[model samples]
Target: MSTPVEQAFRDHWGRVLAALIGFLGDFERAEEAAQEAFAIAAERWPRDGAPDHPAAWLLTTGRNRAINRIRRERALAAKLPLLEPPRPQADQPAIPDERLELIFTCCHPALAVEAQVALTLRTLGGLTTEQIARAFLVPEATMAQRLVRAKRKVKAAGIPFRVPEGETLRERLGGVLAVVYLIFNAGYSAPPAQGELAAEAIRLGRALAELLPAEAEAHGLLALMVLHDARHDARVREGELVLLADQDRSLWDAERLAEGRALLERALALGGRGPYVVQAAIAALHAQDPPDWPQLAALYGELARLTGSPVVELNRAIAVAEAEGPAAGLALADALPLERFHYLHATRGELLGRLGRDAEARDAYRRALALVHDDAERRLLERRLAALG
Candidate 1:
């Protein structure tokens, strides 16, 4: 179990950092002050007990630290206008939650997509550079350089620390949503130690939906993530990965599943026919006792048309196999240019096994096993390969 201060840091890191950035108007400085405040909290809170309002306390502490650093550096000529006398704790003003603004700033259209994702995960998701690198399968130094270049771009381009307006908001919404979903995916498949990323992404999704109630895709994305997360406990058994069809329904989070369904309804009512909405619908279907494979295949088909993603097409093939037959699905999968994708080979292996083509199935499973990385997934593939004997 985490200490109270540790929990508070997780809960408030983004808010405090966002508040500091708004105050200091510099990402690096804001991040450094937030880290210093958390360091102070880690040292003092255990000895003195946690603050009554930890987020507020962290914000004030971080702001003071930043201000003091500015004064010490004598860069007052440049930052003097932004500085203010630190208020006593008794008279501290209520800090507005500026995480939404911070995320928009991080995800500015002026920045590259990868940079926007790295910056948002760093500032808003509060993930360390190493953690972000692990999630993206990149070297730590590479991720760090990306972050540095991103911050420099933000500074040089003078991207405003505010959400865009009107059509601009709509245009920018896609990138923001993509970043949030990428964070969720990172957490979803992350090692157990890093699973908190998924929860953090959901928290961000909830905030995005609440702050932009009119954005159907935001609600759709939240619904998709929540529905999948509802089955998190059932996705693995012991130390092995569990296929969705074999998962124990009793292990599912009933309340979260209901919430996902409600959110899906809300998105659909808002006339959301976007890719995220379609994917949420598929997740909702998967929660059923026996999923409607035909409906799922149709949804995947629609999603493929919308996104033009081969991954979606691969998923469609799986659904088609369930609804139609192995031959039909295998034909679709074979036509795709995804030979290097392990999941494709795995799916083909399953389809071939069902067709009694043991040799081809073995070859397919071997290909999948060669590309598989996750321990649980690798174990599952190994079991499948052995069963072919």
Candidate 2:
């Protein structure tokens, strides 16, 4: 059974950590202080039965711990930066302006975008490096190295860890959006080893939406995460990738689908849009359907217009095939980036098999299967290849 205090601790740590950084004005020290607070909680909380306001208690304890460390080191008169009040001491439970600044600092353009996403997931969302790596489909070692390099760069540059003002905001917004989307993408595309990386991304996106409610892009992202996650349970069979058409719509998460549709509606109403919102609008159509391929096709058309990304075009091609017929999808998919891309080849192979192009489909499936890692995906590709034989 999951303990409430442990749940609260994990859920609230990101925001509390953010607030601490805002107050302390340094990432490394703020993390140390937060760690100390957790240690204290482990020792005292069970006896005290969880303070009425756990977040405040944690924050207060963390800040106090920082002070003790400063004093113990005899830096009391050395003129160090004091912890600025991040949110009122007793009233609102939200983080202060400093937390916002911290977001901006992490979202800084100087940091590689992968590093930005990885760091945000780690520090802001409390995800481990292994989690981040799995989401990105990279090795854990590579992700760890990337994160270490990013931290070193941030320290070396001495980039002020705070939110940016109006003029600079637009320039930084792209990077911020990219990082957020990167997290979402990782969750959306998790390996079989993880229960639901997609769920993790949605959680992070939802948190960001809460922290920045007025930001249309944030809602757009939330909308997208929910829509994708809705299909997760039925997207695969007993160790096989069930193509969308083959998936059992009855198994889709209805509640999450409804919630995602509502978020997309709100996101669309916000109007001041970007690629994520536009892509979400496309996904919203999918979220509402019992696999109505035509509606999905229209959405793909809209999305293709929003961002001419090759990936989007590839998706659009698939949508076109779904709305029309396998022949149409095959032509479109073939013309796109099909080479060295497992999904493209796998898709084309499936289409060709339907078209009675047995030899060609078998070859395509072989190539596609060679590139795929997930067991379920591999099984499906092999099944298709066997069927062709």
Q: Candidate 1 at residue 138, lDDT? A: 94
lDDT of each: 0.90, 0.75
Model 2 ranges off by over 4 Å: 81-99, 128-149, 288-292, 370-373
Report the C-alpha lDDT of model 1 over 113-186, residue by residue, as the tens digit. Answer: 88988898899878899988887879999999999999988888899888789988987888899888988888
Worst 10 residues of 2 by lDDT: 83-92
- Model 2 per-residue lDDT tens digits across residues 92-130: 454343445666777788987778888787777777789
Residue 36 of model 1: what lDDT?
96
Instruction: Give TM per candidate.
Output: 0.86, 0.86
Report each candidate's C-alpha RMSD, comma-separated, in the order given: 3.0, 3.2
